[model samples]
Target: MKRRLLLVSNSTLHGGGYLQHFASNLTRRILFVPYALHDRDAYSKTARDKFKTLGYEVDSVHETPDPVDAVRKAEGIFIGGGNTFRLLKSLYDSKLVTEIRKRVLEDGIPYMGSSAGTNVSTISINTTNDMPIVYPPTFAAIGLVPFNINPHYLDADPNSKHMGETREQRIVQYHEEPDTPCVLGLREGSMLLVEGSKATLLGSTKARLFQRGKHTTEYEPGSDLSFLLTDAQ
Candidate 1:
């Protein structure tokens, strides 16, 4: 079975409502993973309420007795954003990583992720901007996609007074490691819609691509990104 994924950079746009940008793409009944936040109930409620307006019923994995079984029975899976490390650790602790991978890759369930959710969908969480509030057994993620992602990617502001490593510079540092995967800097309000072997850029902004030993490239909305699915580290 081919994978079906909707990887979003951010859940809420600057002026838009929660998940309002891609509400139309969501499945009818979603199994939500709210492990990223400290308060799972609040996170779950927020997701449920938001998805409800979109005509989707959301059941959080935190409320389920067996998260793995939830993944098995879910029509679609939606992972909300918070801390990437916490989310990955929870998934590892609950042993939902492999089950989710199987559900999406073999069972072909629709997988939707935002921000930190998008980070874990990639090969590893090394590209995440979140601090390590907690640690997982390994950096390895679900590997739903072949590469890594830096969601809510920001460009260097030329007028900024605060001097710090830009998002691009950090990703460039990542490429310095031997055999590191390609990184996609998904800007806010942008998303990647993957259907089988084909991946397309969606939303209003352009996504920046960073690969080892190459200059960064910018892809506009509606651009074909299928090449990324095969070019793994």
Candidate 2:
């Protein structure tokens, strides 16, 4: 079975619902991961309400006695965004990381994620823009995708006088040490539609690609990005 993934940069656009893009394909039971949010119940309620309108049943894994069992039975999985460190801790503590990865990578279950969720879907969480308020078991993640993903990625703001290192500069530093996989700077309102080993850049914004010692490239919307799926294994 081939993996089916919808990795989004953000849940909401400028003024749209975060899950609005998935309104058309909403006919399955989704296991929602709400551990990232401080209020898991509230997060689940909001997600349920939004997905319910589209004819989908949503339940938070935290509500279940065995989160891994829920993932095993779920038709699809939706990982909500929040604090990356907290989210990764919950995934490892619950041992859902292994179960979810097995289902999505081996059983070919459909998966959807946004922001911090997408950050953990990659090989590592080093590229995330979130502050690490908590310590995770490790930076290791699901590895559904080979490279690192920098969600909500931004370009250098020239007008600002903050004198802080830009997002791109930080990512460049991430690769300076050694063996850092390429990072995809996915902009807001954009997503990567992955089917099998093929991935396509979706939405209006272009994705900025960061490679070690190579010039950054821009992939326009509707471009083929299947090359990114090449497994390092």
The prediction achieving the highest lDDT against the true structure is: 1
Per-residue accuracy of model 2 over 34-59 as CA lDDT, tens digit each:
98889999999988887777667888
TM-score per candidate, in order? 0.93, 0.93
lDDT of each: 0.87, 0.85
- Candidate 2 residue 93 Cα shift, in angstroms, is 0.5
- For model 1, the superposed segments whose C-alpha errors exceed 4 Å read 11-27
lDDT of 1 by residue, 62-181 (tens): 999998888889989889899999999999999999999998999888888989899999999999999999979999999999999999999999999888898888999899999998
Clashing pairs in 1: none
Number of clashes found in candidate 2: 1
| Model 2 alpha-carbon drift over 4 Å, by segment | 11-27
